[model samples]
Target: MKRKLVIGDIHGGFKALIQVLDRAKVSVDDQLIFLGDYVDGWSQSSDIIQFLIELSEKQNCIFIKGNHDAWCEDWLSLGGTPSVWLSNGGQKTIESYDNYSDEELERHLEFFQRMKNYYVDDQNRLFIHAGYSSMHGPEKEVYSSNYRWDRTLWETAVSMDKKLSKNSELYPKRLLLFKEIFIGHTPTIELGSKEPLNKANIWNLDTGAAYTGALSIMDIDTKEFWQSDPLPALYPDENGRNVW
Candidate 1:
């Protein structure tokens, strides 16, 4: 079967990424949908980007732009350094590219620039780095940043009355926009579950590989998931995101 798998935020945990992919037995025939935040946190951000660029050449992959990725892109392309980004793991991402030549960094910048804000499949399944506030859908969003930075969509889904029928007038129209929505930005670790979470029609795949949690991947159709060992365990000397 050509499985469509949605992956969570990587946060530069390349080793963890490899572990989950291997465990999932992913093949070139499978479609890989990455939820982004490919950089910032661990020490292997640059390596991960390079690997993804290579992987995409032969495998079916969908890359969504993430907030962290946007920050890295600015730094790489314009030499801009936002302090907020540096405080939130951007420094490590910069250090990760120490060995890459200028041309290689440009390649990475191009990769980041080409990422999508959101993707909707033929089945109406939405794959985005974060949520969109537009009731109509991401296409109608007013603020482009919301596609990668908004949390309201997930909050609404999480707080909604589970018993409220979809046909109810109070039902969230945003949730009704898609058959399924896969997102990564908010880590599931903060929710006290180091596993993918499902609320309403939204599936949050960020298991917090940026923090002390694990990397996660899921079969979007089967809902079967595979996780890597705790990211901290994979990189013992590095305090990823230093969130602990």
Candidate 2:
């Protein structure tokens, strides 16, 4: 069977993205599910999106939206970029397109606009950039914009035992609807873990590629994973996460 490979946030660390993919040995047969945050932070945000655009053409790919991606899309489609977004690394995304054509930039914005907030496969595996309310499936109109912005879903899962209760009703409410859930945005490094974390059947794949940890990718079925080196190390003399 073709493998299901889920990737964490890229955060504009294009070199780190390449490293993780190379380590994962991704092939055309595998389905690559990106957990979003493709831009912002570090630099080369445009380069990363272009690379992904080509990669999607070569392989099965699904791109979910992250909160940072929403900010980028809003600025691109409209005029005023939010001050908070710029302070949180949106400026680098702007800088990355210094040499790009208007058409190319438009394409990037369209990609962002078309991205999904959540993905539920035939297996009922849920992939999202952040959290979900769990009150309904991904189709609910109420969750259209909140799925990628909510953090409570993951927090609820983390609060439960890593080994959840056997009782059907005991699972974290947000995760009960899916066979398993994969998410990014909440970096594992911030949780004091340098590795992908599994709790309440939800996996947090982001290993803080923009900092001292690596970008992570995992096989959903086999649970096998790969990582790139600390992204800061990938770009010596440049402050990777200090785009702030």
Q: For model 2, what is the alpha-carbon lDDT of residue 200?
A: 77
Tens digit of lDDT per residue, candidate 2, span 123-208?
98989988866466556637566677887877887787756674757765556678998999888877799899997778999888
User: Over the stretch 209-244, how does candidate 1's per-residue lDDT look in tens digits?
Assistant: 999999999999999999999998999999889674
- Distance from true position, residue 137, model 1, in Å? 1.0
- Give me the runs in candidate 2 sitting further than 4 Å from their true place: 141-143, 162-170, 242-244
TM-scores for all candidates?
Answer: 0.98, 0.93
Q: TM-score of predicted model 1? A: 0.98
Q: Give the lowest summed-lDDT range of ten residues in model 1.
A: 235-244
Clashes of each: 0, 0
Top-scoring candidate (lDDT): 1
What are the C-alpha RMSDs, in order, of all predicted structures? 0.8, 2.0
